[model samples]
Target chain A: MDILPQLILNSIIAGAIYTMIALGFNLIYGTVKFFDLGYGALTAVGGYSVFYFYKTLGINIYASIILGAIIAGIIGFIVYKLVYTPLRTRKSSGMVMLVASLGVLTAAQAIIAIIFTSQFQTLSINAGTERVFTIFGGVITQTQLITLVLGLGIMIVMALVFKFSLFGKAIKAIGDDEEVSKIVGINTNKIIGWVFFIGSAIGGLAGILIGFDTGIEPTMGLSLLLKGVIASIIGGIGNVYGGVLGAFLLAFIENFGIWKISGEWKDAIAFGVLILFLLFRPQGILRR
Target chain B: MTKTAKGILWVIALVIVVLIIVNVSSKGGKNSNTASSTPIKIGFTGPLTGDVANIGQNAKAAVEIAVGEINSAGGINGRQIEMVYEDDRCAGPEGVKAANKLINVDNVTAILGSVCSPATLSFAPIAEKAQTPVLSYCSTAPKISESGDYIFRDVPSDLFQAGFAAKYTYNTLGKRKVAIINVNNDWGLGLKKAFSDAFKALGGQVVLEDGDDPTSKDLRTQMAKVKSSGADLLYFAGFPDGTVAGLKEAKTLKLTQTIFGADAWDDNKIWDSLGSSADGVMYTRVGTNSSDAFKTKMKEKLGNDSIVYCSNYAYDGLKILADAIKTAGTDRTAVKNALYSIKHVNGVSSSLIEFDANGDPKEANYVIDIIKNGKAEIVK
Candidate 1:
């Protein structure tokens, strides 16, 4: 079709956004081994931080974005220390952790709504001045380009860090067996906490970019989280690189699947692929 | 006592207290038509809490103001009007529950409410079967016109508004090829269908059509598809959040097509968020003929200067029902009949409001609002 370039571009943009989410989500799941539903809400946390700092308080845009990500990371760390650490210490079931994360998500969203009033807000100061770029006859905005570059950049950096760094190997060791890692003096809890920080920071960055691209509301987190979760699962849960591959794959399938169908079926197509993966290829495209 | 025994006793106590309160509250509102001529009971339903709670609460305040004025004026035929407010949460099942409570428990003679279309439509069948005159203030779905003989709304349906937009887009804007993208919900779907039908009738081609889940903010795919279609105009339908997301997506896609929106786009929140991206975007909104006095009264009641136009319609809806009750007494059928023959009652919503044979406002008037610099001004 004459629209192939645009469709492909759309898929890649969607993929880039989802890739950021899936990366953090997969990273956290690797060590903690429980679905951190609250991780989703941190994206809104990051986006709103930028809104408050840059748009509301007149801070530098770059500084606000960095502060937004760091704030999300700190909050993620705090939640780990406060809610999840206690539960893990008590040896709670995965279901209990999942439910707790859900509570965290609900409470965080409510608190945000209380503070900011649930209004969708944009992070960009001047909407009309956005730079546009054309690649292979497909139009892409500056924000989307940044998102794509940053998403791939982050993935590569994370992959290298995991492969070559001592901290990465330690995290992998903990993921393999927390008890064994602790016995070997790798500080499982501390490493897991760092992973949470990194993962949540990435999630928040996704939210910040999304706020600039579209807009942000308190409830935007759950949907973003669901997409990331799907990407992680289908790409092989707990596998960092697999999540990245899964993110792009999911985006491509979602955009291209709806090419001949109605756009409303995008979510259905996403969940359908998730179910298919859960059924036939449970380990996904890669194994951890 | 043992822990289990204590838990069971607490549960039993709670159940008894709940039942007692329910029984007493039920008795307080019903069967009070004794020889003393008790206050006329009227039920009001709107979402006091939910996504559209702001609109619902605004309408509630307006209705309360109307009630205060009517009571100060010695009530309807010397019988003081008593209102029972129920929160439907702007949902279908909740609407049915609220309507049931109003009809069966509260025993209201008439209902002036339900700011949402789904809520209005959900309870219309019950209101019809029970012969309870239901006058909606903000519900604008076309299906409401055929809801029931007893059902009436002050606001004109999306059909007329859609027709207006279609004619304007085609003949006025001179757009022959249009793109349609709407939130996948009753309000969006209804407007999209009506607009498409009207545009097609005017010999306009719908070059691209798409619907996104109402909960989704990402309209990139839809925007991309519409962009490739090279349409001259895009008629986007969504609530505040969805509308903001859709318009922003269109901007990100760098689509050069003129953007048009439906009544839901009247929300200032959308414009506030979209900022400069909202510039040149046009939408249809019902023009209100509210007076300075009503504006002052609303400000006094709400402690704010902001006024959504639906609140004006709600105020008028209550006033119209009160007038009907004054003539027809508390009889539901008589109130319904009186409403149908309302002639030309002047109120805040409009200068002249008369119900036609189909229990709709005879005249449908809408104006185009164009946004620039994050504020909307009526262009036509």
Candidate 2:
């Protein structure tokens, strides 16, 4: 009975982490309508930035975090301009775009590995193990709590902006029909560039928080992206609310699934759920 | 055929022919007869590139130093040694290619190398078939024991380290119940199985056992089960990245059980990443008896970041091969026989270096070390 609460807590924490990733993934997919695989490697960019600034250079941690996100955003924007924008101009197929994004992903991951040496690095100066809380008999660390709050907080903020803002309408118009969006003087490329910056910033922030919680590694991007992609697919690839729901659902199922079976099967269980969603409910919980 | 395609094929053919000719002439220029002033060809294969290249590079440095020392000390029975280096790049296919070249091309009498276990395992069969003896310096996998009669490793196997860990956790630490979580990879499964089997043999109860993906950073699912396991000790068999995550999550869950690790936990980066949360965590690793003299010599040769734990064994491995060659001459079978006959010899790695029937080092000392304030201290 006591274990149940902790299992739920663990699921919530895991879900929150995935939600950070899925939120950014959905935000980008919603706008561009192409799976931006390079979005994954941007997480490492954020983490390494913080590692260099806060850990190595002895900068203020908060300031370092802001710089990390901004740098990731700028990098994301540059990648879009350099690689993705040309593809968009050519009106390339989604397959071509996906492959291009994969190139971006591979190059970015390699660059980060070259800079950081592919070893696991910790960004948390304070290990954060000391500051722990037990809520409803479920233990949660300060970093984890921050992760949960920020996940939901960012989701709500993005939801409101999408519902009421001009930029949000522009994004939806481009997503619905890029040709129509461009014809309406929406500046599809510029809007998509900003979308890339915003989405990648969120991804970067997820990386920073994850670094504080569990440390960072260059190759972590792929797995992080994988979980988020699964969540986005299950919730509805382009729907933000669907991504959140799918993330929590996936997390809950994964945590509870492994509770009965051995822990070795956790990833197996996750992939199994992904397969189930793909087969039975391909459109996910909400149809875009 | 297309003109461009015909030209490309011709170019490839020419390159292959040129490579073979160059290879033959190089060896012919170096050595003609089996004796006299000809250098004894010894082949070395290891991941001289890629992520774990540092380990291979350290081994290379140690081998180079050994080669220098042996030559300076009037050579191995007056025949100077020449090392043919091949960069395996830590891949299995690469290892096989390197092994083939070392055997068929360079015609090395003995092979010393291949730091990674996969590479060693991959090339062992080819070397065994070719009657070329291989001595691994850094591969600690128990799987290598069955690799071939011609294959031998100076490093103690993970099975030995795991048994030591299990015994230490059960008898020395006086822990009865243990919860083990390991990576699903070969290294993890091999060590984990060895541990559970040994622990069970000792009448210790394993309350929970699970394997995790090597790349996974989140272990809360496993940790949740472990929290309720009521085990006195938690055993982790993993590399550094996973260890950092496991320790941090374990700390967050606030589990009161003592965390124990296998040989993999000897990494300094794990402790650095975990910080104070790593305090009280203990691990059993194959202890080395690297002398101040050896350390000083290594520093003078290659500077800092050169003295990896594996380098100690690498130094000993090269010396063992050289000693075997000196006794039995350059005959591969004689060298193999010499290795089996060779008994206790004190070297940089440990107090004793003796090969058993399986070509594994007979004497292995496991040191129990504990983390305190984010740093490791030998507790035993």
Candidate 3:
């Protein structure tokens, strides 16, 4: 049976989630020039917030998702103020900021563990009523199609905003040279704060989408962050369009690479591609 | 040096001081002990921090409850069993240090724990050389027993649990084609191998095999492949973190199938992370909600507010060890012999617990659990 079409569809969906994380990570990394390890924690925040509101508090899932994204935006602003801003003022090295981010990751993970108590949970929306359709010898779920559409829509909107909006131009100017942008009266700090809020909202949306698609756990952020980082690095660090391209490329390679081997070798193939990129074009595909 | 570095150095110094005091006091106490009156001290080690800490803390609580119960029932041959707990940080080197401290400094007669198989493997040789009996409740690696007679595991190895889950996936869930995703670790590898063997033996077709580092973030690549594999089911083997994340991504990508796993998928942490996406996650684990003994004992032990599965197993493990000691009449050798001789002993989770020559429990049932509303309920 030819499952190529189904596989392509699935890869596109997976690529969408990766693009969400990559977009946020790339935005932050490009402008700040420091790894925001805490972005992963925000993903957890987004997932758990929706989980708590919908599953625990009995709120509607759609409402919970909006509430979760808003909360993540708030958290992103606070994290920028508390951690990144102070580090920036200190003229901290990238390594120092990286370490601080790791600390935030550890502390955030510990807090999650303390609150949720480390059990696997599921959203109960389609507990037993999922419908699957077979096309071209492969099966696809309705929920997956929705996620793919949502992801593509969000990416398109983000790309449009980046190309057209005044806020997006300010963000780009800040990324190019924070001092120069500040000299030009850009209010770089406030613009950066807004960037975090918007970027984290995207991350939260990714988290919510992931929750609907898979499941949520306290430690889910780490793997999500790794994928985002890989996607960003592969496509072009700090390049908005690059993340989407990178995610799709990564998905296609991984999906098709395991045709002759056990699927277990899929990751090795992905990492091998990553290594090749690292060795040949350390600047990444788009070379921002 | 930087302020943070200076602070870290001070903390390290303080920890060293505390360790020195503990070591010196333990040495003095051992010397002061009258040869005939020395209590049989036992050391228990595992993570007391981080995500899996709940597993260790519950195990520790169970040990405490069981120790108190056995001591009240009159010590193993009138010799009080004393437990000394340590945090292994779930790492190999820390686990070895914990074992050394227990053996050389505390002079514990036997040691329990060092949860998570990697840590357990590190402490195995140290315990064996010290001639201390080490019974692990958390380590599930099949090779843990190969460290020799000194090592005993209360929980059935992943071999049995993973195989059973794979069989259930094929015969019960009706999954013909499956994809295997495992973490890069002993626990993950062992379970994957076991599942592969059992699934193939049952005539199930495995379409793909994928490995992910438990700590990595981007799983979309591997997940996308699984989605496109045309498989009927997905099997993830790892701690709850990776399993939950992978499952959630699979859901996002619209990869629909029955997801199966081993005991690591049993934690509530997975639910906290996965949220709504966690529904329908299937895994095999020691039954958490089946037997009356576990429920009743847990209620009596932790009250209704804190009943956990690991605690019940730990409590049962302690009871079993104490029973063997009592049945053997005070000698450690006799206790070991009696443990082997026993054909059937009721456990907190089982109606009958019997060990074979390899010390593997016979008729051991790994209950299949389906996640419902963030909790795992026994399905098969």
Provide the TM-score of chain B versus the true chain B for each model in turn: 0.93, 0.87, 0.86
Cα lDDT of all candidates, in order?
0.88, 0.86, 0.74
lDDT per residue (tens digit) for residues A1-288 in model 2: 268889999999999999999999999998888999999998999999999999899999999999999999999999999998888889899999999999999999888877777677888875745588988888888888999999999999988988999988898888899898888899888889999999999999999999988888777788899999999999888998999999999899989988877777878888998999999999999977
- Candidate structures ordered by DockQ, highest first: 1, 2, 3
Winner of 2 and 3 under TM-score:
2
Q: Model 1: clashing residue pairs?
A: none
Regions of model 1 farther than 4 Å from truth: B1-3, B17-54, B77-109, B126-132, B299-306, B329-334, B356-358
lDDT of 3: 0.74
Error of 2 at B65 (Å): 3.4
Tens-place lDDT digits, model 1, residues A128-197: 4689887787878899999999999998998898899999999889888999999998988888889989
Per-candidate iRMS values, in order, are 2.4, 2.7, 5.6
| Candidate 3 off by > 4 Å | A124-147, B1-40, B45-62, B84-107, B114-119, B138-140, B154-188, B191-294, B302-313, B323-380
For candidate 2 chain B, which ten residues in a row score worst on lDDT? B27-36
Candidate 2: fraction of native contacts reproduced = 0.62
Clashes of 3: 42
CAPRI-style docking class of model 2 based on DockQ: acceptable
